[model samples]
Target: MRLSIISTHKRIQKGDIGEFEKLFRNLYSPLCHYAFRFIKDMDSAEDIVQDLFYNYWKNREKLEITTSLKSYLYQAVRNKCIKTINHQQVKEKYNNVLRLQGQDYDDYSSSNIETEELNQIIESTIDELPDRCKEIFVLSRYEGMKYHEIAQRLSISVKTVEANMGKALKMFRLNLKGYYQISANQ
Candidate 1:
């Protein structure tokens, strides 16, 4: 039986198209069913089995089948199924990684927009402050000046400087929360 199988394989290798067709007719359905057991999809199983036969025929000159033809065909079908499953897994992983990267890009873009909008709101709010309050706020924040230094420089009471700083702080707090709502809603 083994010798007959090998001889048949050799005949197919020697460009025997009729012999190859007979072998394919005998094995194709069984091979597809065998592949479906592993892959769980009839269409994919049929394709895999068909591809296996096509590749075997195309590369017959380079291939050697040491076992019985039945064993060789079964083993080849199993290997093709495993390869298909592995390829599908790789494609799924690649797609998942792309999705995560897309989300990261979106977050980075929104963060930049939020920062720019907050800066504009802050600048406009600062401009609206009472002139003395804005000056006090800028000096305390931008120039890193202490309250007493600002009061002496402006020839104002320390209490007056403190009042102006409090009003500026309150305005900023309200704007900060308002900006948070605007960004969150969008």
Candidate 2:
């Protein structure tokens, strides 16, 4: 039985749909439960698990699993949960800022103009960053990757990740501060 399962997995890895469904069926529920532990939300957990499987299938040509298949699935799900949590944190922060500012402006047109200006400034600042620094910053901030994970993915050291991130933040703060000051004066 174990040999047959291993053969099936290898076949799926080679793009065999019949074997892929068999392997997916065997692993789906367990992967969902694994994701639920990290996310604490059943529907989101299931979605994450489904996405992981889809990505795995899409990237099967480059897939390399040294450990058990279950371990690989769990790690993918964990990373996805981390990304989801980080996105929620950013949204919550934005909401809090809006709430404290009390969006009761009588001139909606002015407010919309200001919002567009701020967005453009932010986008321009991001575009002005050094290539590697911008990549690291986006991966860490937007993708919610930890320093070690970023380092591993980029084949760089953790110290390099930290240094680059610090530079990125400093540049953003300087640019964004100027943008806000100009907006306030207008």
Candidate 3:
């Protein structure tokens, strides 16, 4: 039960650390980018790729590959990204149930707790953003301005505003991950 890259016939015996390392080095970045396309977060994408490689190495002797190594790696990354998304969705659903049940963990009213924590997370995440991106995001979201309006106010193109807003929302999603599990990501 040894793993082999079927197309290249590159046999991966348990002791072949050099070959394994080479494969990892060759594919890690590309796989991370591929995962990022699905998850929209670099950190989570890298984690997914790294975890895939780790598990691939851990059970090398017990695994079988029916496709090219690259294909297998890509498929694994895609599956893991989808799994992560699904897991996040499930957590979001659970959180929604808690919210609906009116479970209060502190002194604030239910609405106030969610709003305050949400605003805090948004502010902290925005604080970490680049200056221009932060300004654009604040204009579009906090100020309730449309993209075109924000762009005009900042004297930038609407496309620029859209790109910055995308970056900001991506950052927000990444930061909220494992912290808030808000229903919006659902």
Candidate 4:
């Protein structure tokens, strides 16, 4: 039976399955097609429309339609389509960040595993150095102290400071050559 918006809403609220089914048959396709225009996927569009109708049926007693039934259905589908698109974009961005943080690296910072591995190798190698050499190297490289400043701070000669730095550089180069090559290739 043909029904106006008011009559259809009243029937739905009264739990009249026949009239509600008629409204569903009349509106489902148009709403799905409208959603498809925004989301570009047939199955997702169909799901949005189906969920809308199912929620409408479940919440009929609390439903309020200030607009026509067609307008309400179309607007609901449009909002759902926008939400789906926004959600997909967020998921894609999250995956991209995960790729950057995980094994996949492309011109950005090195991956987490590579960075952590390098840090571990460097720390262990520095730890293996003579105490004075480690102290001089860390002050010079990590603390950004010049040779004279390091020598003054540690009460050593500039010659000794220079020697320690040279030794640290050689040790780092020999230890990290392979790791550096691997990261560079990646």
lDDT tens per residue, model 1, 124-174: 989999999999999999999999999999999999999999999999998
Per residue, candidate 3 scores C-alpha lDDT tens digits across 102-128 of: 653332356676788878987899899
RMSD of each: 13.8, 19.2, 19.1, 9.4
13 Cα displacement, candidate 3 (Å): 2.5
CA lDDT, every prediction? 0.87, 0.82, 0.81, 0.86
Q: How many clashes would you count in candidate 3? A: 0
lDDT of 2: 0.82
Candidate 4 lDDT over 1-186, as tens digits, reads 344578778878999999888888888887888888999999999999999999999998998887877777788888889999999998778678868776333333346667789899999889988999999999988999999999999998999999988898899999999998987886
Give the residue spans of candidate 2 off by over 4 A.
1-9, 103-186
Better of 2 and 4 by lDDT: 4
TM of each candidate vs. truth:
0.51, 0.51, 0.51, 0.53
Among the numbered candidates, top TM-score falls to 4
Q: Which runs of model 1 end up more than 4 angstroms from their true locations? A: 1-3, 103-186
Ranked candidates (lDDT, high to low): 1, 4, 2, 3
- Each candidate's number of clashing pairs is 0, 0, 0, 0
